[model samples]
Target: MKFDELDGKMRSFETHHDRAVMPEMYVVARIDGRGFTRLTKEKHDFEKPFDERFHDYMLTTVQHLMNCGFNIVYGYTQSDEISLLFHLNENAFSRKERKWNSILAGEASAKFSLLLGDLASFDCRLCEFPNSGLVTDYFRWRNEDAHRNALSAHCYWLLRKQGNSATEATQRINRFNTADKNELLFSNGINYNDLPAWQKRGSGIYWKDEEINGFNPVTQQTVNTIRKKLYINKNLPFSEEYSKLINNIIEISGR
Candidate 1:
């Protein structure tokens, strides 16, 4: 055969021999929790406002999910539930939907379970949503609902703290003007109006540092600090083998 014909034959043979599967384009994972109401009630009832402790619990939960091989692309929180979006093609961690879904649920529940172990009040569960739109909307709707419910509850608690009767407190809280209900919170000489944009996006309980320095993502933006270390071992290494394996996966998955 001519050289061109030989080369063409080889290329065609390789193309026929190679068979790699494509990964799914989207994944909708739902995570939910309970016992948070009891926790919130205790915090609201206590003299100390539920800021630092509650915030820590949330940060720890998010960090826990990251460690379990999920990339939290976006997060939205309502009263007790949080909706998180993860990267779709996580071949290193999520090769299959079933395994990835189980891991996500397990990590979230485990974190909350530990955080509330002292109080013995909260439990969490994950909901599976193979449909992307439903999964995304589920969190958005519920989170906003949670925020409204929290405000109403807080208003009632505040009225009760002022020695109002149950009926009176409910009425007063429900009667709060829109502006009053949406008023920003101030603490330790810091105005809620001055917090960073991200901090203001929703109520984040753990961001006490912003109280002192005064956050302004407008002037000072925050970047995600995910990778703590990036070192490859030189000796006793399967580095080349590992790289080939990753490339093979990417190629197979068509990423």
Candidate 2:
């Protein structure tokens, strides 16, 4: 067979199952750390529940992803997972699902591993929503999840510190209600409401217009300029207000 004919035949086998996200739909790529429990707890011994160092590393990784050759409008991270909201008009790789998954996973894993000085990996999956309302709901879901996880972690760690084994802690936490967890922390001298907002609500990264005053060398005059920069929000709102925030981001990005 001719070279071109042979190449064409092999390419079909590789792409036979390929799929692309539909146009006009919002794309959210969620990248999650693989085996991060072992990596964070057993290997690196990062502070339990939350660590500033680990949080900074995750924030840096999210910033890298926001600028890593995609039309991402917003980035969110909590715990060991990241969610990236692509621009509404993004058509990169013709909206190929596999391309987005592979490249995002590779980029996040590489960036995080470099920051951690170890071999770490991440897996990526895409979520598609038909309307902005659904997008708002999606983020709201993750936001609430962060709250639940934070409460559970604080409760679990408290039990562990009180001489409960891993299994005992897990079992106790499993039986506790939301009020019970809060009371547990309260009784132990820790207030769940007093914890850092970032731990409970996660963090959001979005582009903002920053005003800069500088001297124009050629004109020899002071000038004002607008620069686009990423803004990190650690204290995110909840319920209806959170929905508004997500919608506002989508609306501004569309503009």
Compared with the true structure, all predictions reach lDDT values of 0.47, 0.94
- Best candidate (score: lDDT): 2
lDDT (tens digit, per residue) of candidate 1 on 1-255: 999999998989755643322364444354555555555665444222234455556656655665566644444443345555544554644345445555666777778668756432323333444445544455445544544655555556555766889799777666776456556132223343443322222322111112122445876954543333211111111234433432332243233
Model 2 pairs whose backbones collide? none
Clashes of each: 1, 0
* Residue-level lDDT for 117 in candidate 1: 65
Q: Return the TM-score for candidate 2, rounded to 2 decimals.
A: 0.97
lDDT tens string, model 2, 1-255? 999999999999999999999999999999999999999999998998899799889999999999999999989999999999999999999999999999999999999999999999999999999998888889999999999999999899889989999999999999999999999999989988899988999999999999999999999999999999999998888889988888899999999
lDDT of 1: 0.47
